[model samples]
Target: MTVTEISRLALYGYQIPLNPPLPVGRQRITSRHGLLLRAITDQGEAVVELAPLSGTDMDGEPIDGFSRESLQQLQDELTTLQPQLGSTAALERAAGQTALPSLAWGLGLLALKLEGQLTSRQPRLAPVPLIYRLPNETADELVQRLATLPRDCRFAKLKIAQNDVEAELRLIYALLAARPDVRLRLDANGGFSLTQAVDFCACLPKGSIDFIEDPCRESADCEALHSALGLGYALDAPLNAPDFELSPLPGLRALVLKPMLIGSPAKVQALIAAAQQLGVRCIISSALESSLGISDLAAFAAQETPDEAPGLDTLAAFEADLLVSSGKALCLELGQLPLLASWEAGC
Candidate 1:
């Protein structure tokens, strides 16, 4: 197999339902919104799908940093460059681009290279845990739903915001009462003030909650929140910003990596390596990407040794019909999710 020709590119937009609206910090999400990038070879026999994070909005808007503009620009550039270079060189150049779509493009290009070479190695994809979202209904209903999930799904995450402290806490208590053996994590999404975050974490019983993520507004709050909660803390949105320097947040247990927001895999790997050196755990999570993007992230996660169970379970929030009907399944077993197919035609 040799680098002979480049073919076509296609972008597909998809909307999938969330069983129950997912509440995270100040935002209430009811569906998974994203775009899929497909690269086809000249042979017309190979295809690679890349799903970079398109945020919650499917249409390109607000053209700011980390917006859909980044993806569009990368696609335009790749289309222009593909005709000028061979397969391997194109992939290398695509991988090194400064644009946001570079990671997804690189992953897709690598998959293409593998197909061209007829390599038997399958792209790595680890099982992602499933996360269930609770509706804004009664705590009893939420508990009942939890009881219905498969027994192997013993780890779950819930969203909290500044306004719903009491309700959230009550919900947490109810969940614990229903399944005491489950590990629970709270994602605040920077909804609380420093003082409020301290008070909120302090209200929880020690060891009842596993860890809380991004409760406060500033990176500086990591130490303060850790002290207040008397438990481990993780950073999500804070890590997404490039201006924020990466250092070990005191009392931090895990650092969540969102590749689309961070721009590239090498950069994410660097952060993960730094966190490990500082004795902090690393977790690779998605920003509600399509299966294309999720597949790439899952492959990267499979390469990680001793990584924490990531927030990839957010996939369950959507209806399955929205995805390609013939691809891999997203089922979880013993808290792990299996990888989906990379090509629709079995390339």
Candidate 2:
């Protein structure tokens, strides 16, 4: 059998503007600037885009807690290590020494792609169920965005902990009442008090919510609230920096996996295995990376939990899709990733 060897590695940096700017927590994400790697192999090529949340927001303010890993580091590593990364085994070994989880993940995926092990089942490129993040804005603007929701849309995720509590509540009520059949996920980012979380969860008509994420900071508080309401919540920030030794919690409905931040590809696989063993659902989401990141993200999510929609509606917020070599702003569907990568690679 002919082995698909790594013939070349191409590194790139891009800053794609975001329209209407996604406001998550305090950051108004106006643009995405990150590093990507193209692993050119005998078979074809595989793309990996790093999704670091530490980039500056639209206001040019630094996003809190971004790691020290930068674009230059990834490029330098690829350049210095190019000669050594000639085979799948070599790339797999390289991933362990790399400090940046995103970089390691990229190499790991490239190896898998070249070896024809990226997927075990099929050659199909299908769309994952995506949950749209409702922007935290005025009631009128919220109503307008809500109006665009597809008739068949089954899930919606919203952020809370607002200055205008009444307005936020009104929007939540509207979403719940309007689409009783649709399950909603509220993310407070651990910024709320237990009382506030309880109040917010209480407002929901029974069975309208799928889960809440990081409602409060303390696990004890969250566990108590879970006892009170019997509603489950997923851990986001906590899971990002996990020890991978967690047992099942009563209210841990799911673990939102961010492949880039979670360590090497092996670590991500272990985390998923652990979560599945605990009977917890797995939801893979991106950190707002460009085409490279979203491409692998959709692949990973589809591989793990294709039926459950990952949080990938962030694609709709971009002003331009930098993945295209022509650099035109076009519709980016999951199926178009390979073509987009080839275009970017100028192949």
Candidate 3:
């Protein structure tokens, strides 16, 4: 069997500022910190990111909802493997041993890129649909925001279960009244109990929502909530569960696939195959990665779910760009980030 080869490698550390701070779960983050990997192999040059999402309040209580391991943990793992990172065999072995999804994914992508198995054959630009996430704003503000959206943008996602339930309901009703052509996707981030989710769903007008994502903390509870309301639902964190299984559920409509949170490229393709077999839509979503990472996701979405609109509207939160300019649309291009280390195979 022929193995992939990486003769040179470089690592970069970045602290891109997030304009207005991005809120996830219980914490608001002013900046995003992570590492970038650039490698030279027989196929050509390849780049991938290792940005793990974590959420902590000012008091540091560990509220990370998206990432399974902290950023420090990921860095520690990389540090241990730094000695042999230039060897494709070493990267493959380390990827097999690590439980951290971000690390495994980074290594896996490196291998794929080295073999020229990704993007080289796929279309450079795929016209996938786009979903815009409405920022938190008052009724009038949201109305103006909706009015400014591009004519082709028809779907919108809103974060719920964070503030007053009644107020959120009113805001949704008013926003829809202003632009009834837009379909809404509500994300609760698994913040509600079964009863709470049911009660919240009951208040919304029937057929007003396309789907609700991560309505409850437990997958069972999420399924039960779907049963109670007969509303379509999408799975997010459940895709990262240690014992996640792809089975048929009555109201299961979509799987929110975040490559950073998911283990490896192989596993991601497997999940997509299984989900599609079960007639569930697969949505390639982002984990607030930098422009480089977001561009990678745009390529992946183009190759995988070309027909579905991806949830990649998080790029506007970044204050500056990485390798590319901050204002450009998503594309498969690598730009220079702050270098942390460089290694060449025999040097």
- Index of the highest-TM-score prediction: 3
lDDT of 3 at 115: 61
How does each model score on lDDT? Answer: 0.58, 0.67, 0.75
> Using alpha carbons, what is the TM-score of model 3?
0.87
TM-score of each: 0.74, 0.83, 0.87
Q: For residues 1-347, could you state the per-residue lDDT of candidate 3 as single tens digits? A: 14666788777777777666676664667778888878887767777889888746435666576787887787777767767676666666677678998888888777766665566332233322233233565567866777667666667788888878998888788768876877788888888888999999999865778789998877788778877878889999889875688999889999999989987777788899999999999988888888777777777787888877788778776877767455654332334445677777535
How does model 1 score by TM-score? 0.74
How many residue pairs clash (N, CA or C atoms closer than 3 angstroms) in each of the candidate models, in the order given?
3, 1, 1
With a 3 Å backbone cut-off (N, CA, C), the pairs that clash in candidate 2 are: 129-309
Per residue, candidate 1 scores C-alpha lDDT tens digits across 23-98 of 4335455665444444566555333344444444223232222334344565555455544334544554555564
Question: Of models 2 and 3, which has the larger TM-score?
Answer: 3
| Candidate 2 Cα deviation (angstroms), residue 38 | 1.7
The lDDT of model 2 is 0.67
Candidate that scores best on lDDT: 3
Error of 2 at 24 (Å): 3.5
Report the lDDT of model 3 for residue 57: 40
